[model samples]
Target chain A: MSVLSLISGASIPVQLVMAILLLASLFSWYYIFLKVFTLRRAEKQTAEFERQFWSGADLTDLFQRAVNARDSAGSLERIFESGFREFTKHRREPGTDVGALMDSTRRAMRATYQREMDKLESSLSFLASVGSVSPYVGLLGTVWGIMNSFRGLANVGQATLSHVAPGIAEALIATAIGLFAAIPAVVAYNRFAGDVNRLAIRFDSFTEEFSNILQRQVH
Target chain B: MAAAAIHSRDEALAGGLALAMHVLFLVLLVFGVSWQHKQADTAVIVDLWRDLPSVTPPRVEPPPPPPEVKPEPPKPVPKVEAKPPPKPEPAPVVKPDIALKEKQDRERKLKEQQEAAEKKKLAAEKAREAELEKKKRAEAEALKQKQAAEAEAKRVAAEQQKARDALAAQQAAAQAKVVDEYKRQISAKIRRFIVLPPNVSDAAQVEFEITVLPGGEVLGAKLRRAANSTPAYDAAVERAILRAQPLPLPPDPALMRQFRELNLVFRPKD
Candidate 1:
């Protein structure tokens, strides 16, 4: 079947609406695939960084390099840089309170965490939009389809089940397509939200632990 | 504890990126709306006000302020005309049942005529084959005589009396006759073995699908559609098919080649 013709034959205004919905679905799905890869890559990098951090590397050397590599900063490396930079800067200031110094470092790290979270969350709202709106879009198409079906029935001499079947089939296809687009979107949005929350939790915990480390070292 | 905490961060980051991207994708998908083509709209309503002028609306009269005319006419009402009875519609011209019967008879005659023609053709062919066999035998005898004469000339010159040419001539003729007889026998056996279903009358027209093994035996038969079935008539046809199993295989390479698996349809009679 020619999908274009199938969609084109529907009511005019609805066809436009359906076209927009379909485009949104296509765009969302494409982004979904893209995000999956991007997230996977980010995860792999995070894992690699953590492994390196525990690989007997000197913390001071790691911190110095991370801080020095200011121009090109990875999210994880940036977070570390912010915390360590705050720590060194506080130590240098005369009579800086150790507890207060750690607090400044923690805030810097928290800011970096927010930035990273924003980057991670980018385009997530689009997914949310798609998840929420796709069904309504599909419903619009379906409503249009049903209207056309009724209009067609009005012209027919005798309306039998068979006579009405094709129109109904075409109409139902819109709702089905809408669900098809929406289900995956909703599921993906939920899953991604949960993952982002988990990651945020991890960032918060990391900041606390790093603050404790700074606390002991300075004190 | 610190290590455990750091590891959790790693896990969270990975999971977070995935969730964020997926959510974004879903949001974009839900809001996007392009499905129906704009060009398909065919709604139209035609107004009839412009088509025809009103017949009784040209002379508008104003109402009088007061009634001025006085009328007093006591007249008897005209008698109502007697109602005429509805004319009974002449009975619809019913053609004699002969038309249907004639058509049926014509079909039956045509079918019988076709069967007779087929039977006559088969008989004629069998007779022709017999004549050909007779001619073949005569030619074989003449060839044997010619060979015997040549052998006698060579035997006398070489002073060796040989029965070789005579024996070979007899064997050749015997083999030729045996082949011809075998073919004739096979044809007869085939004719006798086939029991075409009654419903599949020589007059019936239908396509059949029959699967067969290497053996001439019919493995299966089926009508691919109801259009092929002739009601309870198909029962008689099916019976004939079952009765005609294990068809006698012909020695003719051409016939045997196609005899393996085959389907054929007959109309009326062929």
Candidate 2:
């Protein structure tokens, strides 16, 4: 049998396995590109917001800009807005202490930080699962195919390489496709996960640094 | 909230990109497979039965007679078939109604002229009697023809069965003859190489099991039964067998099946 016939002639279970692996590969590539664009955008937005924050822009003006930019605002900008809004609301109270004001502001910023991180982290698990499990699915197809080929050998009077070559070839295609689907997924997952971690550290440091600024102003 | 909206747009974009990439990948996969397929598609046809240009003389005789006999019967069958239609068609035909109708018309005109009603009625009654007799005779003849056709069909069927049985027996005999012919040729070739030892007994026989390849090369020759004659005669026979390196074998694979492991009985006297 030829290469084309080998795939088309594969047993039903093997075909099913190949189909699942193909779909996994397709969706994983989709997420890989999507995450690439998204992570790049997040990193770019965080860098722009950080530059503007450290440029000594007025806090009230920055807060107003963040609110106006609402949907387009980056993770760091949103954390800054939530923290400034908390500080302003507590300052209106006549007897509110500096420690309590800073505490409430940090809390609001931390909450917004967590939500932004969640948004970035979405679908990363899907890539991880596909990367880790697709090889085994392909292995199942290979094992089944080899078993069927050997079983056919039992009926033949003379066992030859030609008898088993096609079946084994068809079975191996499963493993090849499995690796094909998994390598990119695993690679993309590691790259994106590392990028997201870097973003998280940046957001955490900004939250502590912004609290220090607000603490000095209140005192 | 704005992130979700932007995320949806990204999702749509990603979906479109994914679908396009998969389509491209599938096209590449199909093209690659079919490309590699060009070389693999060529088929090899092995010729199991090689035509023997030198061995044509013996095979020329047996096949012609059966073919000649088979073709001869069918050739003249259609051309000389003049018996069936004329014999059955002429006997059952009777035109009594036309003659009776004309007579009645003539009698009616005559009766009207002569005013004889009694004579016209009697003639009508006689015409009816004659028509009844003719119909009865036609029915009997038709029944006889149908019975004769049934008998002819049964005889033809019996003859066909006998012919089929004879053909099967002839095929079996032809196959046996081919096997015997190959065996004798192999024995003759080995005998030509024989340098017989003197003073061998008339009853001394040496039988060997000869195994041959498709190309008539002797793969092996083992002594199954040694000649009770002197050691020299036995050695001479074995030497002659080995000297006949490539034996004579039939070109047909079906005939070769019998010659694969041949039992050659070497009788010095005969």
Candidate 3:
């Protein structure tokens, strides 16, 4: 039987299930695309910002640059700006201890790091849910279809293959569509999750390295 | 700062490109897969039985040979009187000449009678055989003629039946067309007379049976179903059908049978 026939011949529940799966697949794809672009940009911007930070530019000048171009600043650059801003604010206090000042700067940077990570992790859960649950939804539709087809057999005196084949084919379509919805989502989720994790690690290491530089400058 | 601004612009451009790519991929997948599936669906399924070799007809058993007629046995030849003791050499001194000549003549006459009887019996046997052969030939000719007549009658009857069937189908089709045309005309006339209240929001349908006379006169009208609960609407529909008096009907009396008890449904639209 043709795909069209399989879809049209499916029971109402099966059709509804297929429709839901299709919508899920579409949304997953949209997120998959948007995340890919966002993650890649974050990585590139982090690398560029790191190169600029280490190019012997004065810390005060770098902080000014980050603030002036705040809208376009990378996540790593924003962390540096917040930490440096706190450092300069505390330094003007005549009796501020170096240890306490360093603590406040680290706290500010850590807060910014988490907010950026949260942005990166956004929508990853949705993709994971789609990947894991769509197949079961499709399975539910298939089971319903098969049950209906078998129930219909009670009306017949003798069941033949032709009588059962179309129903089964229609039922199987739900599973096929479910798998279609699931496979891509699962793949995209795994790949994006790995990318986000790697970016988070890079951001964490940059924060530590920047704090070490500040410690030396304070001395 | 300038570098960060430029990087952001690049990021936005990359996102736009990625979205376009995905949209393109989606369109291709939907159209490509469905189109391929449709092509596969159109494939023709050939019945293997259609190509099977033709079957030979079963052999018919030959008829049993005709009963053999036995020829009558020839009659036995009658015995001739033992030739009178070869005329004993009659001595000229013992018998008179007249007596000797009379005795020889009597012997010849008896031999002739025996030969004539033998020839007559042979002729009678030949005549009986000829009569039997003639009777067999006549019976065979009569049977052949009877079988030919029967086959001809069957063929003629089949042809006549086929012609009658074709004529009946043609008549039925023509009558149906006439009935449909008349029904359309009647509906159109009734539709012109129907009037619905302007405030009614929904379309309404009224089903009723109308009885008509042979000359296209409306004899009675009865409402069978009404979509709305309003009695006025049902009554209005009944009145419209009645006003369309002498519902258009085919002139053919035979076609009148259909219109005699017709079920009419009216759906009034704005």
Name model 2 segments beyond 4 Å from true.
A1-3, B1-5, B33-270
**Per-residue lDDT over B152-197 for candidate 1, one digit per residue giving the tens place of the 0 to 100 score:** 6665544322334555555556545544443344334433534454
Task: Give a tens-digit lDDT track for model 2, residues B1-270.
Answer: 587798888888988998898787777776655534355566887534343233322332222221111211111112222222111112223368786776676667655645445555566667667766766766776677667666766666676677666776766677777677667777878998889888888788888898888888888888888767666766777788788877777767766778789888887875
What docking class should model 1 receive? incorrect
Pairs in clash, predicted candidate 2: none
Using DockQ as the measure, which candidate wins?
A: 2
In order of DockQ, best first, we have 2, 3, 1
Model 3: residue B17 alpha-carbon error in angstroms: 8.2
Worst 10 residues of 2 chain B by lDDT: B68-77
For model 3, how does the per-residue alpha-carbon lDDT over B11-65 read when each residue is reduced to its tens digit? Answer: 5664566467556755665566743333445668642322222222223333333
Model 2 CAPRI quality: acceptable
RMSD, every candidate, angstroms = 39.8, 15.7, 20.9
RMSD over all Cα atoms, model 2:
15.7
User: lDDT by residue for model 1 over A1-219, one digit each (tens)?
Assistant: 334455556667666766677667776676566556546555665666567666868768888877675544456767877888888888999999876887789889989988988988878889888888888888877887788888888998988997666666566667766776777778888888787777677667767766787788886
For all candidates, state DockQ relative to the true structure.
0.03, 0.29, 0.07
Q: Which stretches of candidate 3 lie over 4 Å from their true place?
A: B1-58, B61-270
TM-score of chain A of 1: 0.88
